[model samples]
Target chain A: MIGEYITSNTEIVESALTQSLPPAWQIPLPLRESMNYSLMAGGKRLRPILVLAAAESLGGTKEAALPVACAIEMVHTYSLIHDDLPAMDNDDYRRGKLTNHKVYGEAMAILAGDALLTHAFYSISQAHKVHGIPAERVLAITEELSAYAGARGMVGGQAADMLGEQGITKLEELEYIHSHKTSDLIVFSLRAGAHIAGASHAQLQALSQFGHAIGLAFQIQDDILDIIGDEAKLGKPVKSDEKQQKVTYPYFIGMEASEKKVRELTSQGKEALLQANLVHPERLLQLADYLMKRDH
Target chain B: MIGEYITSNTEIVESALTQSLPPAWQIPLPLRESMNYSLMAGGKRLRPILVLAAAESLGGTKEAALPVACAIEMVHTYSLIHDDLPAMDNDDYRRGKLTNHKVYGEAMAILAGDALLTHAFYSISQAHKVHGIPAERVLAITEELSAYAGARGMVGGQAADMLGEQGITKLEELEYIHSHKTSDLIVFSLRAGAHIAGASHAQLQALSQFGHAIGLAFQIQDDILDIIGDEAKLGKPVKSDEKQQKVTYPYFIGMEASEKKVRELTSQGKEALLQANLVHPERLLQLADYLMKRDH
Candidate 1:
């Protein structure tokens, strides 16, 4: 039922992203090409769709939320690029194509990632001024983004996850990693969308909790997919996480336990949305349902 | 005479910069540490001082402009970090210490640079709110920052500078490289300070021009120092740029002509300041004088 909204919003978000990036003919040819290459490589556009949907769920128009929605996707794409660097996950491909470093060399890849990150702020801060949204509102949204995306949030989570790979793996530590590395930006995207929409304090709180739960469920589902999903659809190598000795929900706990936990989290996420009394949460619910059921 | 003001503001700028970064005890120990190591390595803090001094010149308090001052320094420091990476200039030492990747390895260095850049927006966006400045003003400053600091400005300049090393370099191309690479942030910092001070449009324009001239003169002087300065004081090997076959003013023009150009640019910078009729222009004049006379 909500697929129509998703399709339309995805188009809006993709166009905004394509328009937001600098063209290839710019002085820095390879950097822009590398950025566009990864960003243009197809994905489901889930995070950005959530941004638009979250705003719409709180009575905001999709058109007004497009800038930030695109900004979040840029950030997500940058993280993927950096994560796939030789010093990190060491992956050569993402979404079935050469990762940024593989195509443009490591230095340009690093610069491309840096450029994308800085451009995200640029897009949100300047690109949206034409829409006549209050700069203060945009300021608040950009601030929240830096908080969730930066060291104390996603970067912090990534550091911990990297450190954890070599050492002990407590469940609580894993939770911290999942919640911050994955869920923090997810929660921020939702809140940023809601803040733009002028969602109330209660509603913001509800979305925060809902996004947190969904973020964890999403990661767990990823873990499950790595264990059981097909090689072709997953793009890169399947079961590579296990091969890399990465900590996963199913690795520590049995597959059944992980499945039970994802189910519980999905229900809890929907319950949080219900508790908020959002006027139009049907779209959000459908998005959550799709995530909960997705294989890749 | 104005050296006292520079000293005091440098202290304030340093202290504020120290406080601005996420602490080392945070989950991302290496990222924060690498960021801090470079940021705290102690440069002149001239860019940030211009921010504070420009504000004070227009009847604004230093405390009010501290957040922006710190933010600019963060951006500058992040650039240095990235520039020193093995993929870029590949310097082993910066500001008299091991470059970040030389100490923490390439990946952490890259991530640290990313974290600092993102955190600059976070610091500027959230930290300045407590000073009771309107959020829109901070928003404006941050937006200006992303514009000048991102691809169209500094990054573009850097890419040109990098590519220029490998190709035919025109005089105009060199100007574009120097103006964007070295001058954009300087201009942005000065304008940002004036913006916070509520300076008139005329005053901001004057500061922008002043910064532009000073930035070019500063880079020219740096080229001169590379040829003749003491290695001990410069902190790295002298003539390293020549060794790397990097472009420079003295390389294209004779050293005498380069020195003559710096003198002209320095005088032009002060002329802009004089035309502005700033209330407290003495300190800025001193800064220009210092830049003109600096040898190390």
Candidate 2:
């Protein structure tokens, strides 16, 4: 049922994303192609799913959360596009496809990323204009999206991760990178969903706590998988962390410890969610378990 | 008097911008440095001035418009940073200083640009949250900002310009590039300022017309300046457009024709503004003249 839920909701997200972009003739061909290329490239749709799941748990309609969900996905996609640039990770592939810069060229890749990031607010604003969400909630979501994704949140995290690439001597530094770089957007995803559902302050706080726990747990699992996950399933080679000399949870704490930590954190996330008194939390609870166990 | 108004408003924007970014201690040192590097770099502050000027022309207070003004400036600065990347224009300098990528490596410059773009929406949200501008207006501004700045607007124009770099076949294509790349933001700035001030539908339409006319005219003047403007005042070399083989207004038409076009556009823009029945259209009227006559 959880699998079905994810698949169905992902379909919803995929459909909305297709409609999100301006048509080809409406914009320059290259810009349109570049933006579409990355956006349509497949991923798990985890962030947007979290948005819908969180909203549904609070009895909010998918209609209300869909635009913001797509917005979060766009933000995530833009980050991937930029992070894969030659100046950064120099990644050649993502989800087994040629990276954005590889196909579009670096200039188009960068502009495409820029366009996606800028368009995200437009996507979020639609929740109010088309879906009849209140102006106040829409504004709050906009503010939160900026805070989570800007210098103080996701970008800040990315900067630290880049800086830490030189040398990560401390676990706290690693945690900081993971929390900001990997976790902030996840937290935003959940919080945005809750906002749309009109959750109370306490419920919002509970969701935030849950998001933090799962986000970090989800990242640690990625680290574990990098060392042991199947290359084909991951759609990339394994042990990439070792290949790059990139510091990771397992690099510092070893595989057993990393796996243990993921389990503990997933439990903590579920506990937080369970305490939130939602009409339905089963799907989110199952999602945490799935993320903790995912190979990619 | 117009010069004094611009200087005073620039000061207001300067102060707001100084406080816009998260403090150094709050983010990674290098990322903080990169973002501040370009943001703090000075320019005419034309876009923010347009926001303030348009708002005031409609009898709106500067306080309500200032945040959105700063947001517009942030968007402009981000575009400049991205445009200066080695993969793009490859410029080494801007505003008489080292360009962002030249100073802070390409990776940081890209992230910094991303940060600024993301934060601009956050800044606009402040107009509603902090300055008590209505949420509906803030949401409208957010939508317009995305439209003007995203793939279908400024980015769209930049894409066309980049594609045309190989060979410009027509004046219409050149106009398309200028109108979208340069003028879209101008129109957004004017409309956003009007929204903050609660301008009537007619007023917004008039300002849009005024923005489009002046935006094209201003770009034509740039083309002219590139051909015959002073090197010292221009900061960068004159006729660099020719060096780059860029298609410009004067490239298709002679310099005299281009200059005449600028004058005609300015007159039309001012005429549109005069017919709007605004409380203080004089500043905006004078601004069109200033833009037309500007040497750099």
Candidate 3:
């Protein structure tokens, strides 16, 4: 049943994403192709699923959370596009396909990412105009989103991450990178759902705590997967964190410790959700378990 | 008087921008430095000034539009940074100095531009939180901004401009590039101010007409200046447009015809402004004239 729930939601999210973006043909061919290359390439669709699951658990319809969910996905896609650039992660493949820059060239890749980032807001705005979400909440959510994604949040985290690998990594520095680069947006995804659902302040705060824990757990699991997950299954090389001579959860604290950390965080996240008095937290809790153990 | 107005407003905008961004010493040093390099570099500050001028013309306080004005500048600065990348415009200098990537490396330059573009919305959000602007109006303006700046607007324009240069030039294709790339934001600046000030529907439509005319006129003048303007005053080298064999107004229509077109558009813009029945048109008119006749 949980698998069915996630699968159905993933399909729904993909459909919404397809419909949300300006028709690919409406923009220049190259730019739209580059954007679609990454966006449509298969991934977990975890971020948007989190948005819907959180909203549903908090007593909001998937329809109300659909736009916000898609916006979160757009932001996620933009980050992936930029992070894969030659100057950044310098990866040639993502999800087993050529990276955007490889096909579109670096300039077009950058532009495509820029378009996706800008269009995230456009998605929310459209929802407001036609879907009839209250304009005021949309404005507040927009403000919150910018804060979560901009210099002080995701971009800031990315910058720290670039700087963090220069030498022997300190735990504090690593935490800063993971929490901001990974956790900030994840936390924002959950809160975006809660915001649309009109959750009380206490509920919102609890969801934030839950998301932060799950986000950290998610990254640590990724670190673990890089060592143990099948390369074909993950759609990229394994042990890249080790190959790069960079710090990761297992590298910093040992694999056993990393595994323990993920377990503790997952429990904490679920507990926080339970304490928030949700009408249906089972789907989200199941999702956290799935992501924590996912090979990819 | 016009010169004094521009100078004073420029100072005001520069101060707000400085105050608004992350401190240069925040989470990452290189990222902030690269963002500041282009943002703080000297230019005419035309976009932000137009924003303020539009607000003043429409009977809104300069203070009310200040944050929005700064946001526009951030967006402009981001565009310039991306446009100068090796795969794009491939320029080494802007505003008479080394371009951002030249100074900070390509990765940092791209990240900095991304940071600025994301931060533009943050700046507007802060204004919404503190400036006592009505939330619904802020929402409206935010919607309008996404339309003007997203895939269908500035991004779309840049894409068309890039493609238009690959083949024979047509006036219609050239106009699409100019209007979207150069004028979309210009028009957005004017309308953002009007939306905040509660312009009537008729007045808003007229201002849109005014902005469109001025925006077209502005690009034509830029094309002209690329040939006839002083390189020292303009900062970047002149004639690069011709060097690229790009379709430009002067190259396509001849300098005399282009100048005449600019004059006609400027007259149309001013006529539209007069029809809007603005209480304080002198400042905007003066600004437009200055832009039209500018040597730089």
Candidate 4:
């Protein structure tokens, strides 16, 4: 059920992303090519699709959130490209193809990531001018996305993750790392959608809680998949996390306990969505369940 | 005269930047520290100061442009930090202090750069809300900044710079590299300031021209300084460009021709400013002269 929703929303998101990134004639041809390479690299498009789903469930037009959806995906993609750089994760493959650095060399890879990140905001600000939405609300959504992705959020999480790899064995420390590195963007994705939809304070608060629960569950499932899933199925090398010697939910708690935590978090996420009395809560609920149960 | 203006504006910009980056309790203390380390690292603060001066010169309140000014600096600082990373320029020292990667290690440096860049836009959006600026103008400024800093602008320039280093004997290629890189930010700085001040389109166009000329002049002077300036006066090592074999204006144009080009560009910049009818054109004209004439 969640797969069908994601599939449909993914189609909407891809079309939106393509339109958002209308080709620039002035940019060097190679630069444009690199931008397209990273943007068109196939993935689930989960962040943007979730954004659209959340907006639609909250009774807003998906079109209103399209630029934002694309913007979030741009940020996500930029992070992935940078993460795979030799200085960072050093991965050779991403989404079943050579990473940006692998194809473009280190210098161009860095520039490509920088371009994507900056363009993400460009995409968001452009969304403010997209005809129907109040500019103030669009500005507000942009601000929230920036905050969630910046120092106090995702970047901060990444810093902690780097430090943790040197040997942070405490469970709290590990959780802190994951919350910032993985969960922050996830939470931002949901809140950004809700913000565009003009969700009430109560509804926003409920979505926040729902986002927090599912975001953590999503990370836990990633941890599990890293251990048990095949490389081909996961679209990257399996046990790569182990190779990195990074801490995970299963590292702190046994695999069984981690699996239980995923179930508990999924339930909490669904409960929060129900409490919000969303118009179409089933899609979100099913997504939470599927996130915990997916093979990859 | 331009040195005096930049120096005075630098003081104001530094204080404003300090206030803008207050410590947050929620972020891990070390992450916060690393952020402060890179942000507080002393540099000219020319870009942000240009932002404030441009806004104020056009009769906008200093308070109104303060956040935008800081945001510009944040973007500048992030670029510097990332540029110094091992995968990029691999510098061990910046501003007479250990570079971010040298001090914080590679991963933290990467994250620090990412955080600063992301936070910059967030800061601008927050400032827009606090200042109660029209959302359309805010959106416009955001879009402009992104375009200037992204692939088509600064990043594009950097790519060309990197590739140009491989073997560019052509003076035009060298000029193209610096024009996009250093000049793009300067252009953005001037335009962003005018943007916040609600300058006329004609005025914006003139400032852009002024920016382009001075921006190129600024880089030319920087290239000149790298060869001829005193180490103590420059506040960093001199002649490093020669050591790196990095393509530079001096390398392509020779000292005499490069010096003449600087003078020509400075005059063009001042000429552009003359069309503005600005309240105090001396600040800008002096800035151009300073860029051309400064030893450091």
Each prediction's RMSD over C-alphas, in Å, is 1.6, 1.0, 1.4, 2.2
Q: Estimate each model's TM-score.
A: 0.97, 0.99, 0.97, 0.94
Best by lDDT: 2
Report how far residue B71 has shifted in candidate 4, in Å: 1.0
Across A1-296, the per-residue lDDT of candidate 1 in tens digits comes to 66787788778888888888865565467667877888888898888888888888878887788888888888888888888888888898888888888988877777777777888887787535767667777888888888899988887787777767876468888888899889998898888888878888898899999999999999999999999999998997889988988878887898999988999999999999999877799988988888888888
Whichever of 1 and 2 has more lDDT, that candidate is: 2
Chain B TM-scores per candidate, in order, are: 0.96, 0.98, 0.97, 0.95
- Candidate 3's C-alpha runs over 4 A off are B24-26
Question: B1-296, model 3: which lDDT tens digit per residue?
Answer: 89999999999999998887876655488788888889999788888998888888878998988889989999999999999988789899888899998999887888888899888887887667888888777887777777788788898888777766778457888888889998899999988888767778888788888889999999999899999988887887788788888878877779999999998999989998899888898988887788788877
For candidate 3, state the interface root-mean-square deviation in angstroms to 1 decimal: 1.3
Which should have the higher lDDT, number 1 or number 3?
Answer: 3
CAPRI classification of candidate 4: medium
* Stretches of model 1 off by over 4 angstroms after superposition: A23-27, B23-25
Report the Cα lDDT for residue A295, model 4.
Answer: 81
Q: After superposition, how far is residue A257 of candidate 4 from its true place, in Å?
A: 2.7
> DockQ scores for all the models shown?
0.69, 0.90, 0.73, 0.67
Backbone clashes in model 4, listed as residue pairs: B2-B286
Model 2 lDDT tens row, B1-296: 88998889889999989998877788888988888889889988999999999999999999889999999999999999999999999999886799998988998999999999998999999999998999999999999999999988998888888878988898889989999999999999999999999999999999999999999998999888888888888888788778888877887889898899999999999988887889999889888999999888
Residue B241 accuracy (lDDT) in model 4: 79
Query: Could you give candidate 2's per-residue lDDT for residues A1-296 as a string of tens digits?
Result: 78899999999999999999878888888888888899999999999999999999999999899999999999999999999999999999888999998998998999899999989999999999999999999999999999999999999999888877879999999999899988899999999999999999999899999999999998899888878888888888787777888889988889898899999999999999989999999899999999998767
Answer with 3 or 4, whichever has the higher DockQ.
3
